[model samples]
Target chain A: MALDQSFVGRTYPPTDSYEVGREKIREFAEAIGDTNPAYTDAEAAKALGYSDVIAPPTFVFAITFKAAGQVIEDPQLGLDYSRVVHGDQKFAYTRPVRSGDRLSVTSTIEAIKSMAGNDIIDIRGEVHDEAGEHVVTAFTKLVARADREA
Target chain B: MTAKIAYDEVEVGTELPAQTFPVSRATLVRYAGASGDFNPIHWNEKFAKEVGLPDVIAHGMFTMAEAIRVVTDWTGDPGAVAEYGVRFTKPVVVPNDETGALIEVSAKVAAKLDDDDRTVRVDLTAMSAGQKVLGMSRAVVRLA
Candidate 1:
């Protein structure tokens, strides 16, 4: 089934603030085998002018992708999660994410297209700090492949 | 955070030292736990095959993380990255073996995006099993 073109430009409400944790940042850095001192040592981060340990560039994906679940799970959209594959990802940051900061994301459907029997959905997640300062914007493209048996 | 590299010192086509990262099943498992992405296709071989994948695959986000290290490592500050993006063109198939897979990443200064901001765009190419896994991968970093 084709997605509702009207769903394009639909904006979801802002998500509750998710506090960034130093340990979580360390864990993520370790998982990727990144040993950059700023990711683990608060002093090193401070030396670099950050108030706290700063997360790696891709760390916000965890937060923003989760917020995008609202659009992916919308029944009216009829997206089959099992068939979906991440196609592309982009992020523009106003500043690096620092530990102890509380962030929230508001997701909006940027575009919806159908091509070669596949459904493509583009979601833009705007992240903000507790003070409503724009922190980053994440653009995600999800492709739902055509069902073989259908 | 300020970048270690000076904008005046870098030119278009300047190359960053290439690096390779190994990805085993354990690596994927650890990434899944840390990133909160418990997709079965990243771990369960059978489920991945059932889903039309060759075998267990690495997460696209994980690959993206690995690729950007080239830029961050060069800048000497993780916070210097202003923008980053990638297209998952191919999956990095990880075989269940002692040597699971290797992602080789190399980047170069592609263009000078801004002068006042001292930012340059770096284009990265990531390969695994001799096939490009990411396309249109790039990062815009602010330099001192």
Candidate 2:
């Protein structure tokens, strides 16, 4: 099925509040093979003026994708999950992500198009602190294969 | 974060130290679990081959994360980063071997900004097999 062009410019509800815990941050760092003190040591991050340990950059993916699910799983969008390829991702941060900071994401379907029988969809996720401060904006691109190839 | 280098100490062409990120199958598996991006292409060689890929590939986010580590490590703080962006130019092919694959990352200071916060733009590059995998890479890092 062709992608539903009508889904362009759609916005998803803000995600449920995700409390950024120090341990989750540590697990992410360890999984990525990063042993940075700031990610694991609260004192290290405190020295940097943070109240608690901070998450590594790109740690927001888990949260942001959870938010983006509202858009991708939209039944009306006609996105073929089986044929999609992660094309790219870019992050613009107003501040670094830190543990203990509750965060939420609001996703928007920034763009959609068809090229060479492929459906290209771009999603922009705006992450904000619990206090309603903008923290980061993440852009994701996905390319869906042609139905004929399926 | 005691940054000895200030915006005035930088320019449009100062160079940051180069970095290299090794992509091992184990690391990829760990990342898949951490990031919740359990795509088969990042782990299953058979599915990768079906898509005409060389082998199980590295997650694009993993590559981006390694590159960001350089800037954050240099700044001595993660919050110092104001903005970071990258365009995935190519796939990081991971061969199933004991040693796995490697991607070298290098960057230079591209610009400086200091109206409200002291910051510098760190331009980065990731290459594998002598070919650019991620390009137009850059980050703006804040300073004390």
Candidate 3:
């Protein structure tokens, strides 16, 4: 089934704020084998002018991806979770995510298209800090493969 | 994070140091826990095979994160990256073994944008098992 084209440009409500914790940042950095001191050491981050420990650039993906769940779970979207694969991802940041900051995301359907029998959807997640300041925007492209036999 | 390189010193086509990132099943498990992405395909070999994958695979996000280390290490500041993007063209398959997989990343300055912030666009190539796993990988970094 094809996705509803009307969903394009539809924006979901902002999700509940998620607190960016220092420990979680450390764990994420370690998982990726990044030993950058700014990721784990507050003094290092402060020296760079950040108030506290800042997460690696990719850390926001975890939060923003979770926020995209609302779009994926929408019944009207008719997206087959089993057939979907991530196609592309991009992020633009106003600043690095710092530990102790609270963030939320508002997802909007950016585009919808069908090509070569595959359903391609683009969702943009706008992340904002507790102060209502823009933090980052993550663009996620999902491709649902068409059934070959069909 | 203090930037190690000055913008004026870097020119278009300057290559950052390359890096190799190793991924094992245990690494995938740890990443799954850390990222809160509990997808069975990234952890359970049986489930992954059942889903028609060759074996358990590393998360695309994980691979993306690993590839960006080359840029962050060069900049000396993870936050120096103002924008980053990638296309998951191939999966970085992680086998259930002591040595899972190795992702090799090499990046170079592709372009310098006209801006007062001293931003440069970096083009990255990530490979695993001698095959490209990521395509159109690029990052825009603000240099001091």
- On TM-score, the candidate that comes out on top is 1
* Cα deviation of B20, candidate 1, in Å: 0.3
**What is the lDDT, from 0 to 100, of the residue A145 in candidate 2?**
78
Question: Each candidate: RMSD to true structure?
Answer: 0.6, 1.9, 1.0
The digit string of per-residue lDDT tens for model 1 on B79-104 reads: 89999999999999999999999999
Query: DockQ score of candidate 3?
Result: 0.83
lDDT of 1 by residue, A31-146 (tens): 99999999999999998899999999999999999999999999998999988999999999999999998999999999999998899999999999999999999999999998
Q: Over the stretch A36-133, how does candidate 3's per-residue lDDT look in tens digits?
A: 99999999999998999999888999999999999988888878888889999999999999999999999999999999889999999999999999
Q: Which scores better on lDDT, 1 or 3? A: 1
Best by lDDT: 1
Off by over 4 Å in 1: none
The DockQ for candidate 1, computed on C-alphas, is 0.92
lDDT of 2 by residue, A16-61 (tens): 8899887888888998778779899988878877778878888998
lDDT for every model? 0.96, 0.83, 0.93
Ranking the candidates on DockQ from highest down gives: 1, 3, 2
Q: What is the lDDT of residue B83 in candidate 3?
A: 96
For model 2, which pairs clash?
Answer: none
What TM-score does candidate 1 get on C-alpha atoms? 0.99
